[model samples]
Target: MIGAATFFDGYTVIAIAYAMPVLAKEWSLTPGQIGLILSAGYLGQLFGALFFGWLAERIGRMKVLTFTILLFVAMDVACLFASGAVAMMAFRFIQGIGTGGEVPVASAYVNELIGSKKRGRFFLLYEVMFLLGLVGAGIIGYFLVPVYGWKVMFAVGLVPAALLIPLRFFLFESPRWLASKGRVEEADRIVSRLEQSVIKSGKTLAPVVEMPMAARPNAAQGWRELFKGMYFKRSLVIWAMWFGSYMVANGLITWLPTLYRQHFHLPLETSLAYGFMTSAAGVVAAVICALLIDKVGRRRWYIGALFCAAIPLGLLAATGATTPLQILMMAGLGYAMLQTVTFSLYLYSAELFPTRLRALGTGIGSAWLRLGSAMGPLVVGVAISGAGVHYVFGTFAIVLLITGCITALFAIETKGRVLEELSP
Candidate 1:
């Protein structure tokens, strides 16, 4: 249940990000114009992740999660009525608020509930759902978009809501959170269930500190917690990595099919299917990484995997497309390689900052994710319009290599550490 819900929350939005090429066609939008619309959703997501962090502190994780998902269901359904480009963009932004808040809130909530030694693998499993959602999106979009039209792509967003609604009913709140607040009875009940959920693992549930933080803190708590000492420096570097890497990802994923279609002159069905295949690679890779992340450790995998991703990206830029198979092998494989750290970033970034500011920390850092995603297509649009499509893709490759290095140098290792011990 945790895995599926957490994943759907991310995959639902990501599917839309991947489907931008088709959406642009229906609306007759230019690449930069499409980027602008996507940014609106991200802008909302930035705030949602930040604010909801605190909201969970005040209200309980389970209740807030329930409400937040309802927001996703309502707004995503409303998108069907979006009459034109302006309406579509506006609704999309509103929808972002719900979609964006769901994952960060869930991430914090889920992590707080699980024990430390297994935390890395747990988050990785959560990420596997994210990949599954992409597979769901790919399968749906590959078949539905061709037969029905782009609107059906958004309709598929409802599937998570249906699946999540029933499963979440059986969920319990984080005992770490309850214990911190001195809710001894409630906390004990939750912890016992969590303890039982584990059979082979002998690890006991323990909070990092005995300190209480269940209720709301001052506004200064968020602002001050993030900037104090080493935190400020860590924030800057992590944000840079998140921003730069995602810029490359969004630019490529959003435009890959269209680039293949227009630049390579492939058929629409063929291009969309190719895009689905490329996205499927990301799903497979993300799942594999999720399974292996704990064993390999976070630091080693992120550094090696993303660096490997950089090479193919660089090649795709330098090569001229001699054949469809060649383009798919390069562009598709490049995207697959990048997913190695895609799920890790959510886990890593949230872990980078302290709990009081976890949501805020993730919000501020992830803003760059949106910023990167927003800029990716706009830059591609410019390069395509001016220099050429080759230049756009080539530039994307360079940026990704740079992002991989930056993440390796700066982001801390969180594999063995208990979630409670994590300051960020």
Candidate 2:
């Protein structure tokens, strides 16, 4: 159910990117205006991550998740009614608040459920639903946008509201969260139900092993603790990772379709098709990362992926990013490498803190994600208008290179270590 919710979050978030080309033509929007429209949702997400993440730690993950799902779904419908740039931006920004809050909280919830042994693969496989949602939007845009028009993109997002029924009825709150709040009996009851379900499936259960006690901070102290002790450094590194990686990845993905249509003069269908191809490439790369990240280890994988992404983006800049095919091939490869890091950060951020702080820390870290996401398109718009397109790739390459170096020097491996042990 979390995965299903995340899928729509991805779809709704990027659907605007796919719709931008047509909307630009119909509304006669300039590059600057287009950038604002594209960025509005991410800006809304920044506030949502901070506020909802704090709320989740206070109330519970499940309740916040349900509210966020409903908020974004309603905004998705509002998107269909938007007639011009200001209205579209307004609707998207409000929608972004919900999408932004859902992922980090969901990441914490899922991470708390599994043991560290298979956590990377298991969580990442679930994380891929978000990428698949991006691909789904691309597929829909490629086939539908030229014929049915831009409103069809928003219309498709309404499908996920139906997911709320299953989410409410079938899901249980995170047991780790329950225990951390001193609701021991409630946590055990939920865990007992899960164990009984496993036994009924005819699989032998592994013996339960006791974990070290993690520090459980009071609600007032959770936010303050993020800036103290070993957590302060971890918070800085993770925040940088979120900002740099997302700034480049989202900057490229959101602007590429519009760039194809306006800058290169490609036909609408071809532009949307090419955008779909780039998004599809990211999904393929993400799947491979999901399968292999545990063995490679989180620290090493991030170091390698960041540097590898920087290479193609640097090449694109050096080559001047003149031809659409060149941009597609080089930028697509860069986006793919970054996509691996982009989707996995939630898993990384959650692992960096204890249960009491997981949602708060992840939410705070992802606020940088929203910031970076908002900046990317705006940067692209400015670059295109003043310094030219190649400079945008040049800026991204430098950012990725610095982020790669930071990862090599500061990041800790969390692959096989238990979460409590890792954080404590």
Candidate 3:
């Protein structure tokens, strides 16, 4: 149910990207203007991630999650009524707030429920739905945009509002968050219910190991706690990872269809098809990464994936994107690997903090993601307008190089280590 809810965030985000070709034509938009439309939700996401993440820490994750779902869905429906680029931008920004808040808070919730031994694969399987949502939007656009028009796409996004009613009834508050807030009895009740559900599945339950009470938080933690002492290094490194990864990932994924349609002048369907193919390839790569991440280790996988993703972009930049097969193969493969980096960052970021600040830390890191996501398309637009397409990919190559080196040099290994032991 959590994964299913997160699907809407990915669905709405990429749906707008896919709609760009039609929207640009309809509004007579400049490249900069189109980039703004592509990025508007991310801008809303920056504020949303910060505010909702902080709020979730105080009020509880489920309440904020419910509210954000309604907010984004309402904005999505409002998008169906947009008159022009300005109104569309307004709607997208507000919609972005809900989508943005959902993922990081959900990450904290999921991470709190799992043992460190299983977190990478478990959380990432959930994360893959977000990628699948991207592909779902592609599938929807390939068939719908050329027939029913872009408005139909926004209409499809409105379906998540129905998800809210069911979520309120079914979703439990994060036990870790509850514990952190001194609601130990409530936390224990939820955890006991989960254990009972698992036992009902005919599986033997493992004995619970209690953490020392001193290690467990009793007071609510504030965002300011993220930058003090042990957490400060983690806060910086995770922010860098989020910014660098999303800048390249969102820049490529969001702009690929538009780039194909406008620069190459491919038929509309072909461009959407190509975008869909890249997104599908990314999902495949992310799944593979999720499967192997525990064994490969987070720091090693990040270092390797970042450099592997960079090489293709470097080649694309150097040779120019004239050779279609080469561009498709190299760019597709690179972006696929980066998708691994993009999705796994949630897992990595969540592990970096203790339970009390987990949501806030993840939210703040994701805010940088929102910043990079917002910048990626705008950067592409400016680079295309002035320096050309090669420069945009080249910039990505450099950014990836920096982030990869930072990971190789600075990032600590987290695989197989319990979160309480590591963070405490």
Most accurate candidate by lDDT: 2
lDDT of 3 by residue, 212-247 (tens): 555543354467667777788889999999999999
Show the colliding residue pairs in model 3: none
TM-score versus the correct structure, for each prediction: 0.88, 0.98, 0.97
Steric clash pairs (candidate 2): none
Q: On residues 194-285, what C-alpha lDDT tens digit does candidate 2 reach at each position?
A: 99999999988898888766545556777999999899999999999999999999999999999999999999988998899999999999
Q: How many residue pairs clash in each candidate?
A: 4, 0, 0
Better of 1 and 3 by lDDT: 3
Can you tell me which runs of candidate 2 are displaced by over 4 Å?
Answer: 214-219
Residue clash pairs of candidate 1: 352-424, 353-424, 354-423, 354-424
Candidate 1 C-alpha lDDT tens digits along 1-424: 7677666666556566546656766778876676676666766676666666667766667887887787877777877777677786787777777766777777777666656677777777777776777667767767777688777867877776788788787988877567555688998987676567664487655553454433444545656756766687778777777777777776777667777676677877788788778888888888788778888887788778777877776776678555667768887787787777666687887677655566556666776776777787778778877787667667877787777777677767777775545662
Better of 1 and 3 by TM-score: 3
The 10-residue segment with the lowest total lDDT in model 2? 211-220
- Candidate 3 lDDT score at position 94: 93
| lDDT on C-alpha atoms for all candidate structures | 0.71, 0.94, 0.89
RMSD of model 1, in Å? 3.5
Comparing 1 and 2 on TM-score, the stronger one? 2
